[model samples]
Target: MKQGFRLIALLAAIALVAAACGDDTSDTTTAPSNTSTTADAGGTTTTTEEMMTGPTFDIGVTEEPCEGGSPDRGCILLGSVTDQTGTFAAASPGLLAGHELFWARVNASGGIGGLFDVDILDSAIVDNGFDNATHVEAYQGIRDDVLALAESLGTTQSLAALPDYIDDNMVAAPATWWSGWNYPESDAGLILEAGASYCVEAMNAVDFAVSNFPTGAATVGIVHFPGDFGEDYLAGVKLAAAANNLDVVYEQVTLPIALDPSQQGAIDAVLENYADVTFLVMGPNETATIVGTVAATWNASGTDPRPFIGAGPTWNSALLASPAGAAFEGGIYFNSAPWGPWATDTPGHAALRASAEAGGAPASNFVSAGWVEQYPLKATLEAAVAAGDITRAGVVAAANSLGEVDYEGMVETVADYSGNSIITSSVVSAVDAAAPDGLTLLAGPFTGPTAAAHDYTGPCTG
Candidate 1:
């Protein structure tokens, strides 16, 4: 009986080795010719693309069976549910490349702990198109195939898929910072954000703005979307504003995340209030549009300059190349939850940039975002494997067990996921002509009293 079992295991190992070794090793992806712009983000409100029934995009992974006791024999299949097309298509260059290099390194290292390779199955990289229905559908179709989702990009989309994740006995690495995701009671060990939730980022940013106000007390305005991503920021802004005695001059959630051709109403509101500072929480595309539009309005109005601040996911370094670059080049700043830009001197971030550039990917923040997702997964998976419970449920427990992930200095503060709550902080950076991605570091490892006050112990109804 023992000999029979050994024979079966050996054959399985051979098949695994063949599967692991059968693919071309080019790490670079041919970046799509076009990148996303402000128009694309604004157009999301008015997009005409019919939701495709099936996303055929895949990473095209092939593996070879391995010998008994070899590292390749243990397969840890991780999935990615991200925007490959639709509204956020332009941002995918860095997003996809980051995940690719993370796994590439894992494979090259003879798999994690020299016993298992994290397999990002090609067919499983489905494009969510930034749509809730599509995100859920893509996840449903692939739920049976992967042990867990390594990355699920979009706040509402990821939240929509939460029930499925729980029912399917898995968890995911969400590319968002909704406060609810930070709560143990709400997340139930499913959602894991890359940095401080919007609530924390807003509080810290607001505090910074208030501290730097040169004259009379500052007045603030917030132009945001309506979803948790947006509401989360509103909550934080309000918290900080109240705490610091700043006047909430104007605040509105008038912009639709979908194709809204113009946010003139929102822009006009900020200008009308003449708020000294304005906080934003929109995708990179819309962020650029709003920032440019408002700057133009302020510039044309001949009013005092109103500096703009944004949440991490709300803006990307990609916008500096757009006409909006002029606005950012001005006196504008943004808070990023993750570490420094690709060219940052930090060992983890710089190394990721080198790998991404070598793989033919753009040296941008999106690529680093991908690396951040893998950081916790790597930590959790390594712990799980060591604990001898590497199945779907095991991964979830292991993920929960993940106490801290440094991302090789990608983040100023070590991320803590064990409590199922956000660590509540961020680093600030600014747009500059000389920085790697038109951005220069400011300050970070920011913490706020308001952020600490609201840990989001329940599901975020917003």
Candidate 2:
């Protein structure tokens, strides 16, 4: 992996040199010739010169102001490849809205280094359809037109475009929370991932289940998809189940499109195993199907239903309006999140809420996720601007050099990128029809003993 990264970096350097030497006037690198003033996080006024001459940037940046932005600043265009019409389609709009709102707020607050207003234009946004080939094609379509990807919405999808990202020195905020994003070698130091990974979240979820619903020698059943998303969560559950002395008696690897679209196979597996608790790592529709079916079955049979815990992506507040609505309201389901819900009490959450309200964006956990995911990228861009080199390679370097990023209390502060310093804590929530986003906080922003003690080495799926 190290060798691969070195080779990719070498090739990127050669490509940059070739582009610089070519007759392509559009590929030229130039430093901003104007002076700009900005207030630092400390609220102190600082001149751009204090850092360095304006950044020498290439690609995805222009001297022209962003759409709807002040004409005084240049525009930094970031691309996005997300699910707009796929299995996760219901969650994509909120995620994109969050990305837009975050940038809007940044532009309103004087933009990056007071020189560039960032934009993730809808025109540049591509729909990946939650398919790997579609994701690769979507990325290829916009690779040359953007500075970086503000969002790439799946584990396999991002992985498919990763080789190209490394070759282009493009940095992206991964929408998926696979544990591999935390490792530079795994992702070529390019994925600017936010929040706890599905791996850690699963571990914390298992611990939460055991602590809240104690059953001596409890048994656990896992229903998941087969790839990185599901496999990563499965790995974590195994670790936590071992630590808690819980028997994992059932495991089902299936797809949402399968199981008769009702997830009958999964529901039957859960019923047969009758584990004290079940963990789900699938799409929202599948989650609703399995959870609702199981709950309804138990109720009809006069049997008490066990709790069903879902990974972040497995939930959508819209489920409350489905036939699963009654089942969800019956306290048979819980969810593990990378951060607090939409109504979390924090400066960041407050800002997000304000942005959503002002923009009329839908209230959804995916929206909060979309907002939270941008913090690392925002910090990286700011670092690049401050270092006087907002080029593609410069952005990657800036991302790696950061020791931390402030999330304004939305989640724990992001640790440095040089090692496995990914946040381990997770937020746990339960269904609440009356709560914002239909989720009420149960416990969270907390790390389970298993996750806290687990050895950090590499991707769980790997």
Candidate 3:
């Protein structure tokens, strides 16, 4: 795999060529202007500097790479609360392993500027069990001990602990992709969100499907679970459909996440309606079942296949390696994540693989995400230490002041932490047997029909 910056966004970079003029107006080569013209809603075009940096796949490590363990520092504690026994338990091991290995690299480099070390084994890792009460209890038990949270998984559980984090002026790397973080009104800037939100992913999915469809306007079916995560996707699909003039032929909201016997009926309803595209928003387990059901039941004696679009949470390596992948091989699509798959050959992916292998951790895409999760935490905390202030509020200021964090070249788009600090770009990936984790990216680093276009003034209507 080629390792370098590959800009896919429509930045319109203007490279000026100086054909050595013999008359010699000036011997020095004139630098080309780096501005591009993008039209505003007013129908007038104006030049604007790129708000974000181009993509890269080579960000190797935190600023400091701790080799054979750093100097004798006191201790700098950063913690993460992940699900170990609940609905998302299947994803917890790999996710937590990523975070653990990230700090392991950091601690080896000399522990947060060589002043303090991160303790992932002791009080650093907590199990939320995907339960809100457990999340609250875990945070309450350890909030005062750690510097800031490295990760807090789950939408509902993170939402449950928001008040406490905000009240304490604490910062955390939220594991959820809820678009509410993009709201200008909400001061949850403390929660640094990595990757694109569900809203933008939905928009990108619709855009991809519409761009590739053969002839007439397409009809989209939206089957989502009842929560902010699913509703964020539902809201985006509705927005994209309305904007692109696509039909919401079958929209079934309030679907519980259980592998309920009623799921087959919902599958039947969408298929019966002849939706050109189906968008599913749920966890990996439910996704495996739904996708499997559609692939199996879509044919009786003959074969009729349609496009299946799924959100990021619906992806897992286990499912891809299971019977589910065999059933839904050709016609399934998943949106691109913040980071690439395990098979990606970038420096970051290589390090993660080596760490997982040495540590005997379950390697998956979530582990890559767990590694990406440390980007902002390291950036903001390092800035705080540099300023000689390690207080809770100091870390908040440092985090808020950050405008961008390196994704180690694994991510195509650099995360801009400015303003709302939401990374609003995603690629549409197809399921590929040859691809790592069974994902082959198609289109995007695309951003439109984003949260910027939606109404995030209030809570997501689940």
The prediction achieving the highest TM-score against the true structure is: 2
Candidate 1's residue-wise lDDT over 1-462, tens digit each?
000000011111111122255675653332222222223432332222221111111111112332222433445677788887765676666777788798777667776555566767778889898889999999887887776777888888887888888887677888777777766667677776666667777888887777764643478898887788888888888888888888988887765435676777777787688787888877777788788887777689785676778777666766778888888888654645545655566878767867877787766677778877777778776776666456667667777777766667665445456864455666677777676666667776657566667646653345
Q: For model 3, how does the per-residue alpha-carbon lDDT over 1-462 read when each residue is reduced to its tens digit?
A: 111111223344333333465675532222133555555556545443432321111111221222334434444566788887776777777777788888887776766655556655356578898888899888887776666888889887888888888887768887887777655345367777777777777877787778775633378888887778778888888888888898998877534444374477667766688688888887777777777877777665365667677787778867866667776565554544554567665677787778778877765677777887777788887776665456677677777777667766665434456554556567677777766566766765566554347554553543
What tens-digit string does per-residue lDDT give for candidate 2 at 206-325?
Answer: 888888875533899899998899999999999999999989998898785533586777888999999988899988899888888888789899997788899999889999999889
- Can you give the lDDT of residue 248 in candidate 3? 92
Q: How do the predictions measure up, each by TM-score?
A: 0.80, 0.88, 0.77
Estimate the lDDT of model 3.
Answer: 0.68
Steric clash pairs (candidate 3): 56-409, 57-409, 58-409, 59-408, 65-109, 66-108, 66-109
Rank order by lDDT, top first? 2, 1, 3
lDDT of each prediction vs. the true structure? Answer: 0.68, 0.85, 0.68
Off by over 4 Å in 3: 1-71, 121-124, 213-217, 254-262, 301-303, 333-335, 345-347, 357-362, 412-420, 448-462
Against the true structure, candidate 2 has what lDDT? Answer: 0.85
Model 2 residue runs over 4 Å out of place are 1-53, 214-217, 258-260
lDDT of 1: 0.68
Which regions of candidate 1 deviate over 4 angstroms?
A: 1-73, 213-217, 256-258, 333-336, 412-416, 449-462
